[model samples]
Target: MHKYVKAERERQAQRYRARPHYEQRVNFSVGDYVLRSRVDEKLHANKLRVMWVGPYRVVGSADYYFTVEHLINGRTMDVHPSRLKMYADDSLNVTEELIDHIASQGTLLAVEAIVEYRMNSDMRAYEVKVKWLGLETVEDSWEPLKTMSEDVPQLLLQYATTTSDDVFRRAVTTAIDSKQSQRSTRR
Candidate 1:
């Protein structure tokens, strides 16, 4: 019985060594640059779409996740290893093209401040002129208040109180309150 058990153990060890290693971790060190897989709903529909978005720099790592920061916007995200691929291009043209592609894909830019606000009669929605970080005033554009409430509720609330217009204040307050309630329920 002991000889039979020993043979079975040896066979199991041999099978383990021979089998494919699909569970192997993709090792990434701090300072290594990588690209993250783009997870858009329209990915398969558009054959020409750029799949991977970033050339993010790995800043930190835990057991099964790595913290990567976007090179352009400095946005940090904790991503699984399978979603990341090494970015090794050092050419200036390739980098420029990649940046342009990311911008075209509607990458989230940080909002610096709410410069001004107005009601859009055409859309029947309140719009706020946004000042984006690292961009000039010339690039500022109008964004919907409902969208702003979700993205920057505190900023919208702060701006709402500063305004004397009752209509704008009420609209912004309602949007913020709804957003807060939705968030609380999710928690």
Candidate 2:
């Protein structure tokens, strides 16, 4: 009888422990934006709790902790991964001014092509000429390929298919070769 009681107690404990209690984990990367949860711990706090605060920009990470910058005040803070959610501002419609603001502030630029490339002074990076979406030849600018690729892959794909630009293809080919060689060497 005592053994039966013990077994039943263990089963009950296991059932209780298996009940969901923790929030799901959310992953973040550098340059991603997120809002931090603001849960209150006081009595009946659920009724008064605010969900999130600040659309903070993720700047860096160390293990589970993230360093985020406040988009408005420019303040930097360290926050746990569990307390953060990806930020999406659908509150306003996409306008030209908003696009310009976000483009100027964030690392996102919708453009294509490495029309020309030159080795950086440090010999570690390449500056590639970028042709932005809906822009003319006169406004094209040189940007790092790393940033351009991350921002606009569709544009890159489109630009790479343009058979008319011989110089661009050769530059892109050389860069690809060097990158592949480096990766092989690293292994």
Candidate 3:
């Protein structure tokens, strides 16, 4: 009787463990931005120390592993889905003034520009260029450039001190708007 009871308990435990949790898995694709949780204690010792750090682009992926571009460090890192959060898909729109600010304030230096272009026959191609401090590159294409949020002058300022989200939004809006205007003017 004791052996039979022990076998019954084992069967019940196996059945319970075999049940699926039914949690939906988030899908990430190439070029999609994501935020990765920073596990380093020293960098995130307090609750206020930015819980998430990314806006990292998904560069590659396998069945369960994803390779993301860490813009802050200019490196690609592999991570699991559980460690990543979907970044907000904010439209890239800003004014000319913001572009000027980015250019003059050296914010563009730390970003990589993605250029897209079509030939007279409608054939399209893309190119990537890395921008660094005190350097500039002129690219002719349609692909949009992505700059790290932490590298943005206004965002850096906010991170360094106290500021408002409105300021950050305004700066982003300005920068994106200017780039769009330039593209339109070129065509």
Those runs of model 2 whose alpha carbons end farther than 4 Å from true positions after fitting are: 1-23, 39-48, 89-187
Candidate 1 lDDT over 63-173, as tens digits, reads 889999877667689998888988763332446777666556656588999989988999999999999986668879999999999999999889889999999999999
Give the local distance difference test score of model 1.
0.83
Worst 10 residues of 1 by lDDT: 88-97
Which lDDT tens digits does candidate 2 get at residues 99-184? 45543543323464557656677766656787755456786898875555555544554565674666556655555556668769
Model 3 residue 103 CA deviation (Å) reads: 16
TM-score of 1: 0.65
**TM-score of each model, in listed order:** 0.65, 0.36, 0.36
lDDT (Cα atoms) of all candidates against the true structure: 0.83, 0.65, 0.53
| Residue 30, model 3: Cα distance from true site in angstroms | 1.4
By summed lDDT, which 10 consecutive residues of candidate 2 come out lowest? 101-110
Instruction: Residues 141-163, candidate 3: write the lDDT tens digits.
Output: 23222233223434333332332
Local error of candidate 1 at residue 137 (angstroms): 4.0
Best by TM-score: 1
**Cα RMSD of predicted structure 1:** 5.5
Q: State which candidate, 2 or 3, has the greater lDDT.
A: 2
